[model samples]
Target chain A: AQTVTQSQPEMSVQEAETVTLSCTYDTSENNYYLFWYKQPPSRQMILVIRQEAYKQQNATENRFSVNFQKAAKSFSLKISDSQLGDTAMYFCALSGGSYIPTFGRGTSLIVHP
Target chain B: GAGVSQSPSNKVTEKGKDVELRCDPISGHTALYWYRQSLGQGLEFLIYFQGNSAPDKSGLPSDRFSAERTGGSVSTLTIQRTQQEDSAVYLCASSIPKGLAALPSYNEQFFGPGTRLTVL
Candidate 1:
């Protein structure tokens, strides 16, 4: 079984500031993947970033980046230059041998101008 | 028309009524997934269909929930008896199979707009 955990229920960030959301996952498989998805008010889920477990380097997409620690099983998302549009629900997911992703409870991020 | 699409974006039903949600995955994609997101909760996996293989129904909450993919293109999730607890946003996603190289990006999922089901 795979489990993903996001301890923070809500986070706030000022415009142009940076915020980091914490996430940790547990899986028996050595090869796996981690992802961060953002759900806006429209309720459409958009992929923010993805990281392969085997990769030593972290993954980044524009202002969105991930700090992935394979041994510690920690994958956190950091958003730089936060904007009002970045306010949304962020979910962390893990997919391994099953190819089925298990998602975290989600962290509601609010960016204030 | 290019991404995953779901119908009846919003549904309102009374308790004990049955509801059916539909999903149409992207063309040529062989993997489809259904998930449920309740108020202030994370997404709960409902079921998964990969190509012609049997769906992984382990994540289904109960017998009341069932899904089927026909011709590996379209899928429908049927709730036998609706309950207030069943009220949530149902999401559908589709992705191409992971190629032999196993590049993680190749299997990235494309999600639909989602259907919000409200049971009274």
Candidate 2:
């Protein structure tokens, strides 16, 4: 069984600043996918970014990027130049060939103006 | 293009009653998923459907929970004899699946605004 863990329950960052949310997972599969999803106040889950375990290079999507360390089983999400709109509940997930993802307890992020 | 959609944004039912939640996946998507989100459990996958067939239903918490997809488009999750512990947001997601040989590159899932189910 694969499990994702988000150690931080809540995080806050000032507007224009950066914040990094930590995530780690345990999986026996060698090839898999890791993802960060955001759920806003509207309760809509949005995909932030994704990383393929086989790819040594991390994944980046504009302001959202991931620091994936395969050996450490760590995949952290970094938000650059945070904005108020970035405030949301962020969840880290792991999925293998099965395509069924295991999600972590979300971390609530607040961007203060 | 519209994303996935769920019906009855909020449902409140009493203990021992049955509740049904609906999900309409994105057109042309062959894969659909159901999940439960709560403070205690966070987010947990409940079931997965691949073109009206469920190859994985291991995540269902108990026998009280069951789901089915019809015509490979819409899915319904039914909970029988609901208990207070069943109170949570029921989420639905859909994705286009790659060929069986290319499962690693399966497309990202699109999610719907979940239905909040309250079992009192």
Candidate 3:
């Protein structure tokens, strides 16, 4: 079984600054995927970014990016130039094949002006 | 033509009452998933279905919880003798499956507006 861990229970970032939410996962399978999802006050789960295990190049989506170190079993998300809109609960997840998804406890991010 | 959708945006039931949550996945998506999210907690995997086959049932919390996919489309998760621990937001997601040539990506899940279940 694979388990994902998010060390930070809560994080705060000033607007226009950057913040990183750390996550680590334990998985035996070599072929897998890692993701960051954001849930706002509305409670809608939105995909932030994704990194394929096979790809050494990190995944970047404008303001959101991931630092995936397959060897270390660590995958962290970075938010640049944070905005008030970025305030939400972030989750780290892992999956190999069509199996069940494993999620970390999640980190609550607050962006203040 | 639409994204995933779930009915009864909120459900409140007394203990021992049975509740059924419905999910309508994105059109033409063969893969569907059910997950539970408690307050201030991560998502808990519940069940997954590919087409009509459930290759994994390891996530279901207990025998009282069961899910079924019909016509390779809609899905329903039923909780019998509901317990307070069962109270959470039930989320449903859908994705396209890998076919003979096209391999599916693991991320990119289209989620529906979840059904919030409150068991008392």
lDDT tens per residue, model 1, B15-104: 999999999998998889899999878888889898899998988999999999999899999998899999999999988766675632
Worst 10 residues of 1 chain B by lDDT: B98-107
Q: After superposition, which runs of candidate 3 have C-alpha atoms over 4 Å from their true positions? A: B99-105
Ranking by lDDT: 1, 2, 3
Error of 2 at B32 (Å): 0.7
Better of 1 and 2 by lDDT: 1
Best-to-worst order by TM-score is 1, 2, 3
Could you tell me how far off, in angstroms, the CA of residue A64 lies in candidate 2 after the best superposition? Answer: 0.9
lDDT of 2 by residue, B1-120 (tens): 488999899999999999999999989988888999997456888888887464589989999999888888889999999999999999999888676565522458789999999988
TM-score (C-alpha, index-matched) for candidate 2: 0.95
Best lDDT goes to which candidate?
1
Q: For all candidates, what are the clash counts?
A: 0, 0, 0
Native contacts present in candidate 1, fraction:
0.50
Model 2 regions lying over 4 Å from their true place = B104-106
lDDT score of residue A87 within candidate 2: 98
lDDT tens digits by residue: candidate 3, B29-65: 8888898989878888788888766545678999999
